[model samples]
Target: MRTVPGRLRPRSLRTRLVLIATVLATAAVLVCQATGLTLMRSWLVGQVDDRLTDFRPPEPVYRDIADGTAPAHRPPPHETLPSDFRVYFYDADGRLLPASLGSGRGEPHLAEDITARDPADGRPATVPARDGGGSWRVVADSGPDGMRAVVALPLDSVEEATSKLLWFSLAIGAFAAGGVMLLGGAAVRLGLRPLTRVEHTARSITSGRLEQNVAGTSPDTEVGRLGIAFNTMLDQLRAALHRKDRTERRLRRFMADAGHELRTPLTSLQGFAELLLDDPDMSPARRREAHELIAQNADRMSRLVDSLFLLAKLGDAPTTEHGPVDLLSLAADGIAASAARHPDRRIALAPLGAGYGADPAELDVVEASGDPHQLAQVLANLLDNACTHTPPGTRLQVRVGSLRAGPRTGGTDRPGRTSTGPPLPAGTPAQVIEVADDGPGLTPEEAQQVFDRFYRVPPAPDALRDSGSGLGLAIASTIAEAHGGRLELDTAPGAGCTFRLLLPASGGT
Candidate 1:
């Protein structure tokens, strides 16, 4: 025979539980009823047997039988036997005997010698009548007059009682099954209320209600545990979705900023090409100027494209190849390059002073675990940004220090803000690299948005903003983050902006 699959099976938990309860209840009722009925039938039959075993014939009947004067095959007078019972007599030779003339001591059509010897005791035993009317329990023994006699009782009453008991047992089993179904179904429904709530919550989530949660009862209960687990899962899912939304917003802004940055260079290149192509009689100087403009715009576009590419790579996977990088040497090199590029600007390198809480030699030998090339780019970008943004001859300083107390080593414009970094094991020191410029400082808004891609601090009234592609600071920040560190800005209206880079110090002890 074919069987149904599991998926197609009944899905209601209450129904299944109630069905099991009903089956068990029915079985119990049937067993109890069967036991009781069997015992009752056994007791009733025993009563009949007892009566037959103790049966005695009257003195007159015995005397008549001894003298051979009693009439045989006649009904007893006055009907002394029970209505449903019969008595019989047998001779010494096991033949049917006549009853006393008017005593009615014979059962018609009942044969003498019907009693069989018991297998265990070799005594005359009660023999059941096989006729359809009913059965008889009979016993044979010697009477006072030495005449063998048999007493018999009908089994009709016991059969009727057993039949009634069978019906009663069946009724009780059916009623018990019905009661179990009703009560068990209610109990299952009540106990599974928490699961029902969880199901509702799941459906709500599927329908876009991510904030819904099941109200828990008690942690010690099974349903309570389920509720707690379900709520926790919902919270995690909500947080993940929130993160994805933030990422998408950032991606949209990145696209717009990239497009705007790229268009400016392209427009400049196009304008320069048009200017050179439109005038055949243009002076050599003018042509040279046009060529310079075209080359400059092309370089700008190339740098912007490169920065965008680097940002993309970092965003995709921030983890990169790692090695020990000498922060002091990298900072010095960047400072030297900046000084040479801007000879008119005052640029200096500052070793970690007493404020850094480290030995002077240790500051000079500051090293961090990171990608060397990326770290070099970070320092170069910060130096270039500082030089480009500040006035000519502004004092610029590059400070290399090991932070014993993290971002708190230097007081910030904002009291508690610090560069983001991976959590270090206790007692591990961090390396801080800062580029500070004593120039016209930034406003709060500019400081907040300084690291955003394509963001430029509104140029000073006397300075042109054309010097930057707006991607330098963003790229620097991305590189720092890829190396498991962060870039932070601290500045005020008058206090010059300081860009801090925090990275994990190399363990060389």
Candidate 2:
């Protein structure tokens, strides 16, 4: 596209606009001037013709010529005419009677052929002078005794007047064209001033000044509307750039944390292998313990990798098997399995609205559409998080039921309470599966980061052995989102934590 040089292209809009306006104005002026000149010339010629048609010679001059006794040398002394007018006489035989009438100054000599030809009718006609001086407007009419009288008027005055007018109009047109060009150029520059400002703002933004914005955003005129749209586009661009920058920072941090998590288990496996290689005479029991430790580390690394892969998959496009799954049944199964795993944890199914003080017999089954396996994993992760973080024998209740639209169910805002979840619309038919514990809950700051990958609360001094890989809640949150739901946490520092998995209820209320 750049191969062609831009010299022929107008670089400035102001120049182009002014040039076009000036050209059109000049063209219109020229046309009007030409039309005026044509009309003026025609009117002047018509005035001369009218004068010639009204002219008539004295009666005695005509009677003398008819009697063949008129003098061929000059007109009678008593007869007088305009200095530019002339009269000639011709007989029935079409021969010129040489005597003519005139003021004797500036009279045009008529051609011989014009005098010889019969004057067929009385109408004005132009004929060239015999002496080649100029042209004449002449009219011929019949007179007494078959004599014809021809009257002639010189056209020099009319030509002179029209010529002067033509020159004057040209000068005026030239002046007007120049004025239009100058004033039009100034007007165009003023009109485009706002666009110039917009260009400057864009340049500043391109040079890393993301906060720069265009001014004069009124939507009244074309230029004003352009500025409004330009400012809007700039705002959107700035927001998109900010989001991209934030995503990059998060990605970098995630990579660093993932590497650190993988390195620990890898380092352990290497240490154990090194120990085995250095001591070939190790006892069977010692060797068995080393192998078990290696196996445990491998298993831990495998679970972390799988969680990372699952999170990545969910981030892309998550597909779930569409079917009706009972949240209450899933909750029961999750409770039983969790109880078996941590027999001392005292986990149980809570009654419907149990935390809100509703009767247990009023409980209703909560059903949603999603993959059961993924839902089960979400439940297991929530129970495991509660069990691992709290003291043994902590009273954990898993509640599964539908929440009617409008106010939040079973919870109210309190000091230091925070919710980290996608908002559930107030009009949606929502079913919630909540895993609440009566143990020490998290602070607002911890709650905000709980759903982030590889985030974990500082474990208790005696609970290091039970601390997890920190991806359980993150994976659960992802699964919840994949199933068109959200995992919400309402917790305060010592007020206990409630993790609610809210999904759209499959069957309407």
The per-residue C-alpha lDDT of model 1 at residue 370 equals 85
Clashes of each: 7, 1
Residue clash pairs of candidate 1: 72-98, 72-99, 75-104, 76-103, 76-104, 77-103, 77-104
Best prediction by lDDT: 2
Worst 10 residues of 2 by lDDT: 410-419
Q: What is the TM-score of each candidate against the true structure?
A: 0.70, 0.76
Per-model C-alpha lDDT, please? Answer: 0.73, 0.80
Candidate with best TM-score: 2
In model 1, the runs with Cα more than 4 Å from the true position are 1-11, 28-129, 133-166, 198-212, 216-218, 336-367, 392-395, 400-407, 410-429, 460-467, 504-509
Q: Residues 249-348, candidate 2, lDDT per residue (tens digit)?
A: 9899999999999999999999999999999999999999999999999999998999889888878867557788988889989999988988777776
lDDT (10s digit) by residue, model 1, range 1-509 = 57667657655887878888899989999999999999999899888877766665665665666676655644445335444445455655556665532222233235645333421221324454554455667666565634566666667779999999999999999999989888888898998988898898889989988788898757999989888988888889889989899889988998988888889889999988888778878999999999998999899889888888888888897757788888889988887887787777776667666334545454467778888888888898998898788877677888887765433454222342333334344445668788888778887667767877788887765553565878888888888777766687777877887888877665532
